[model samples]
Target: MALRTGPGSPGPGAAARLVVVGTACVLLAACSPPAPPQVPAPAPSTESAGPTTVEPTADPWADVSDFVPGLVTWDSALPEQSVEGDPVEISLGEGEDPVGSFRRTNVGLSFEASDLADERWEPGTSSLTPLIAALNQPSLRFGGNAVDRRVWWTSSDESAPDWAEFTIGPDDLDRIARFAEATDASVTLVLPLGHFDPERAADMAAHAERALGDRLVAVAFGNEPNGFHHQSQLDLALRDEGWDAEAWVGEAEDYGQAVHDRVPELAVDGPGAYDAPWWRAFGEAEIENKVALSQHWYPLWSCPDRSGETEERAEPEVENLTSQWLHERAETVFGQGKDTADNYDLPLWIEETGPTSCPGTNDSSRTHAQTLWTADFVMIGAAVGAQRMNHHSSLAACRGGAPMSMVCGMGAVPNESPRVIAQSNYLALLMLSQVGTGELVEISSSDPEVRAYAVAGEGYTDIVLVDTGEPGTDRAMDLSVDADRLHGISTLTAESLEATNEGRLRLLSEADAVPDSLPRGSVTLLRFSDE
Candidate 1:
């Protein structure tokens, strides 16, 4: 049977395929004939057992309603695991409401430049269009570390090397603009600053501005210049010329100014940094002309370079993928960006981030855990006052290339494949997009395993609870709200944290609702309305 890959399935992208394949291999192994049992002589210690029987244990949740798969159970009358028999109170009215709106651009996506020029992107037939619509975000960024070496396919006569990757031209940009129009999303094209061709970049930028018109948000220069080889190469180039952080600034200024001079309407975003030192320095120099402070972040090395091979990386470790760890990392990185943005009076944009860098992880990045992690990461980013959080994916995976990282390419089905599978992370983003803009009020949970946040929408409140625990860990939160009624309780879950079932967002009414007892390794959202 053909594998139906995508967001909710066992993963259609290369990375998810790897996980699925690995699991299949294990299952295949189990189906094979077992070796002859090497039974040791019976131990002299114990008396012979009657059929080696095992004792039956009481089911703690038997009296409680059985958890129906794909149903939101929201009954506060259920028993609370804590002492005093009360749900853990999440105090919301005490603190000043942190009011903010979630913009269409707030949940953005970053991809390779080549994806913009692919033929498969044709509006009516392409599988990527629906996926893009599901995001419902206002901005889409075309660039990654790939921009460091990307060439503009300027001429048909320019026969490039097999390894060479190229970006779109005016015609390609027009096609992409149509895509943006279809999805109601804008485009942010990152120039090839690593190539350092101001004239060429300016020409491309000008053409893009004309093609995309108001759909263009901003053009960033390069990807992570500081952490990648781009910076090292620039350092070497500076040996002959004046070299310093200002040198980078001067180069960016020249490139950006050239493009700006031609496409005055397009804003320039830059000095994409991955760390505090680089961001602080880059922000200091580029803050004047830049519209936003762009940066990249990964909790730890998702790719092999920072560690070893994909299989060797520990990104999937349940201990590390916990809510506490992810939340802490978000605080640290977002805090730094927030500080820089505050210091320079600029909006901070996390232009690139994922479960890891380089390529995506297998079991870790492709599992249910990532879905929960993504929910918390995005909400935390919004709460931290970030202007936008752009999830990074590659063209290869989207087009059914190879599996790379947790934020694997989103195309789901392989290129030219009949069906487009949505990866798990994409589904997670789709669920997140449903959260309407409002003040992300504070959610306090006494239990560390459970993390909660509330969006105080004018007359409604959206409560999100994530359980980052091993399977069988029971959790519920007593969310005290002033609303007269609560509705739209839903949960995103899978058979196991590692299972790639594509899960789903199941809606439940008050009768079907179970008090915030979110299943282990899942995310639950509750809507409370004054009406």
Candidate 2:
């Protein structure tokens, strides 16, 4: 392994400044220094949660100490290693055209109506807002599959919807509006559509508009309206009304128009379909009120008995969470949404999505593997032209064998067992936010086992790399950075991809270090100076 050094140029204040990494410090000696060195511990490399290093003690060509040691020298050049297996070669083009831009609000979280109606939504003691802020203040979506059946109550005279159990009222919307305000995020509320009522949706829209102001991005009329046509009771109701793709589109338009009449500026988004066919049909329809095309996605169906069980069974195994599976899914899922959106001249937003379509998968969703999968998911979603990808998190607790709850239900006390904390997906969102928003560029990877995505903006370029090889294997990739100096480096890894911790999602963060050998099932993000 070779550790390449720069042409020995002195950095500003090179003698006085010290960077702390772990417990070690490296002296920045450019030439024969004139002043005494104030050696500080090495600074942390970017916001990576992986192994860190300290400066090497011997000559630049001296024996390479442990690279993954608690501390290794990193001053002028990054640590490099020899090729282990077939190295994944990544090449970034020096093109002026950007493939896409990363949206800070691109990643979002979804909640159920009952979550907002909880008593714990007080001003000071609220756990929801803190958790939202922790997750990078992602756009909040109120309503999941439960929204289709949940009823909103404004007055006593109005009868509840047939599926109404927990009545969500104006106060609940107030709580949602308040939560959105605190988190500095836009709110996308899903209206009941299985039992469609334009009046009810319109009133709620008017209230939300007043409370949320511009924070209310859009109003989705239903949750998976296309799939609703298959439900026994829902099918009978829709059949009586002659409900189909075209009809659903018209209904969405009508409901959206009614909401517009109440609040003229609030935009509408929907059919929230599970497949591409419905998206195409919705796009092809004459309805034009939608500001953004919305859809749902799940890489695999892990919970077999969940609602609308599909025959295509792909379990959420650690092995299945690979570069190829993610690559294909990104190409296919985002491709369909982007194509449909382009056809209709609208932005594509994944209103609801997750690692596993069902609630949770024991093997992967609960483990560190979700972090890698989520990084790929977000980056791929951005690369494919989708503006937002809202990861669906049930407001309720994990029931049965499912464990996909981002927060362990509303009213969860802090410091309590299973307290409301950020989940694996939340960590992924935070990492991307720390990486910063920029123009996403094209990054070609030579090896199929290694995937790379780059973002160029804010006078820096960030390259996110992931090694999707199986256990007991490591991937070494040569990355070319067109820059005068390498500034930031970090990696995200664990004991293994399948590892998980109780009370909290067990994860670790090391100081600054450049990764030369990407261990199996790990993700790393590297930042380089443009100059």
Write model 1 residue lDDT over 22-44, tens digit each, in one string.
11100111111112123222211
Best by TM-score: 2
Superposed by TM-score, candidate 1 places the C-alpha of residue 179 at a distance from the truth, in angstroms, of 0.3
**Residue-level lDDT for 384 in candidate 2:** 78
User: Which candidate number would show the highest lDDT if scored against the true structure?
Assistant: 2
Off by over 4 Å in 1: 1-86, 94-101, 153-163, 228-244, 286-289, 302-316, 358-360, 397-415, 476-484, 507-517
* Tens-digit lDDT track of model 2 for 1-531: 111112221223212222212212222332221221122233211111121111111221112121111122343333343435533445555222334567656667777754566654543344545556544436677767667766554533466656677677767677666766655567788877767778877887788777777677777887887766565335324335455787787777778677777877677777687767778766765543567788888777645564554543366676666648656766687877888888887888888888776443467766666767777888888777777778877545433323665555323332222224445555566556545456676566666666677776544456676666553444433343212234555555555667652111111122233333434565666654443
In candidate 2, position 234 carries an lDDT of 52
